[model samples]
Target chain A: GIQVEQSPPDLILQEGANSTLRCNFSDSVNNLQWFHQNPWGQLINLFYIPSGTKQNGRLSATTVATERYSLLYISSSQTTDSGVYFCAAADTGANSKLTFGKGITLSVRP
Target chain B: SQTIHQWPATLVQPVGSPLSLECTVEGTSNPNLYWYRQAAGRGLQLLFYSVGIGQISSEVPQNLSASRPQDRQFILSSKKLLLSDSGFYLCAWTQYGRGRTNEKLFFGSGTQLSVL
Candidate 1:
């Protein structure tokens, strides 16, 4: 089993501020994904970056597979971004069962 | 397009009561289904996953159990519930892909369970 750890268990920022959330895995992974759980308990897929970089609107993510680390970047954060962000990964040897990290609670104040 | 459905949106039950949560996926065939629990302010924990009908694998040994009665249906059940069972339950599905690269998971709306 692989262990995933997220940094800054909790975070708060101004509406127009920028932030970076990091995730580190203990072992190599074949699948890596980022999800945002909103206040209403909706799990929204933010990114599925096993490697390289991907940008969606004001949110971007980069996964350095070789380094066993990934980063989620939020730019000009909006109040709507307030929620818990989770990082999940699955090892290549398994049947693709995801193991999740505790997550980073982000609050963007308006 | 594939969609997953879970109900009821919220439930409250006394300790020792029976529990059942249902999840169904549409627009896909032979997809991998999963049940996960998220405690307050915590990460999602994988409870059970099924690759096909009648095939289930439990990730964590608990009082909870899951079953796949149909290709697109998954059910989570508990004969007796405990206060510790209170949490948000989510259902998700994914199509298997070649090698290790695959598409992202599609999650259901989620169910909030509270055991008194």
Candidate 2:
């Protein structure tokens, strides 16, 4: 089983601010994803970057598989972005399955 | 477009009571289905996942169990609930045939269960 660690367990930002959330995995992964759990408890997929970088609107993510790390970047943050940001990864094993990090709680103040 | 439906939205059950939560996916066939639990202030934990009907993989040992009786339907059940069972339960699905490393996971609205 792979261990996923997220940094800065909590974060507070002002509207329009930018922030970077990092996720580090203990082993090589075959899949990596970032999700945003809204206030309504819906997990919204943000990025499915196993490697390289991807951008979706004001949110972007980069996964360095070799480095066993990934980052989620939020630019011009809005109040709607306030929620829990989670990063999950599946190791390159026969029984690989996604293991999630504890998650980063982000609060964007209006 | 694939969509997942999980219900009921919220529930409050007494300890030792029976529990059953249903999840169905539409617009897809042979899709991989999963059940995840998220405790308060914690990340999602994989409880069970199914690649096909009647096939399930349990991630963590607990009082809960899951079943995939249909191609797109998943059920989470518990014969006797415990106070520790209180949490937010989520059902998710992904593209079929990618069991080695599942594709982009899509989650349902989630169900909040409280065991008193």
Candidate 3:
């Protein structure tokens, strides 16, 4: 089993601000993903970066598997970006099953 | 395109009542199905996962159990519900095959269960 830790348990930002959320895993992982749980309780897939970097509009994520850490960057944040950001990872084991971090709550005020 | 369906949107039952939640995946065959629960103020926890028909693996020791009746259908059940079983239950699926990297998962809308 692997442990996942997320930093900045809570965050508050004004519209148009930027933020960076961090996730660290205890062991080597072959799968790492970032998710956004909206107010409606839907687990929205943000990024499925096992390694390297990926960008989707205003959000981007970088996973340094060698360093066992991943970062989620939110740029020009908007009110719609307010939600709980979660990072999950699956070890080098056979399955893509993942263990999740507690999450980082973001609140972007308009 | 693969999609997952979980229902009902919410449920309320007595502490000793039996419980059953259903999850079905469409547009895929032999996919990996999973059941996850998100407790209040906690992270998402993997309850059970099935790689194929009639196979299930539990992640944690709980009063709840899971079953894969079909290649794309997963069910979570409890003989007698407990107050602690109340939470947000989510169903997810991903591509499952030999040497295939199923990095991303598609999640269902989720069901909110409250055991009184």
Candidate 4:
């Protein structure tokens, strides 16, 4: 089993602001992902980066597997981006299940 | 593209009542399927996972069970639901891979179940 910790626990931002949420894992992970749980409870997948950097629109993620840390960056935040951001990881190889962090609740005020 | 469908989206059940949540995947075969429960203000807890048809594994022990009767379907069941069973249940799937991510998971909208 792996331990995951998320920072800030809570965050508040104004529209057009930028924020960074971090995830730290205790062990080496083969699978790493970032998800946005909307106000309606939809766990929308954002990124899958066990290592390296990837960008998707206003959202981007970077994982340094060696350091066992991943970061999710939200740029030009909008009201629609307000939700719970989660980081999850799988310590084993393919087909393994994920262990998720508690999550960071982001609130973007218009 | 692959998608997962979970229902009834929301449910309210009396304590000790039977529970059954179904998750089905489309446009994919032999994908690794998983069931997770997210408690209020908490993290996602892995409930069950299946690598293939009829091959199920449980991550935690409580009052629930999972079955994979079809290649693209996974079901979570409980004969007697407990108050603690109330939460948001999610179902997801991913392809088999050998890389850092292996394959990214696609999740369903999720089910909000409240046991009274």
Which should have the higher lDDT, number 3 or number 4? 3
lDDT on C-alpha atoms for all candidate structures: 0.90, 0.93, 0.90, 0.89
The predicted structure with the larger TM-score, 1 or 3, is 3
Better of 1 and 3 by DockQ: 3
Expressed between 0 and 1, the share of native interface contacts present in candidate 4 is 0.71
List the TM values for chain B, per candidate: 0.94, 0.96, 0.94, 0.94
C-alpha lDDT of residue A61 in model 2: 94
Better of 2 and 4 by lDDT: 2
Cα lDDT over the full model 2? 0.93
- Higher-ranked by TM-score: 1 or 2: 2
Please, what are the lDDT tens digits per residue for candidate 3 over residues A33-101? 999999899999999998999999999999999999999999999999999999999898866468899
DockQ of candidates 1 onward, in order? 0.62, 0.81, 0.66, 0.60
What RMSD does each model have against the real structure? 1.7, 1.0, 1.4, 2.0
User: Which stretches of model 3 miss by more than 4 angstroms?
Assistant: B97-101
For A9-80, candidate 4 gives per-residue lDDT tens digits of 999999999999999999998889999999999888899899999999999999999999999999999999
The Cα RMSD across the true interface for model 3 is: 2.2
Candidate 3 Cα deviation (angstroms), residue A68: 1.4
Consecutive 10-residue window with the lowest summed lDDT within model 4 chain B: B95-104
Best-matching candidate per TM-score: 2
Write down the TM-score of every candidate.
0.95, 0.97, 0.96, 0.94
Arranged by TM-score, best first: 2, 3, 1, 4
Candidate 3 chain B least-lDDT 10 residues: B94-103
lDDT of 2 by residue, A23-66 (tens): 99999988899999988898999999989999999999999999
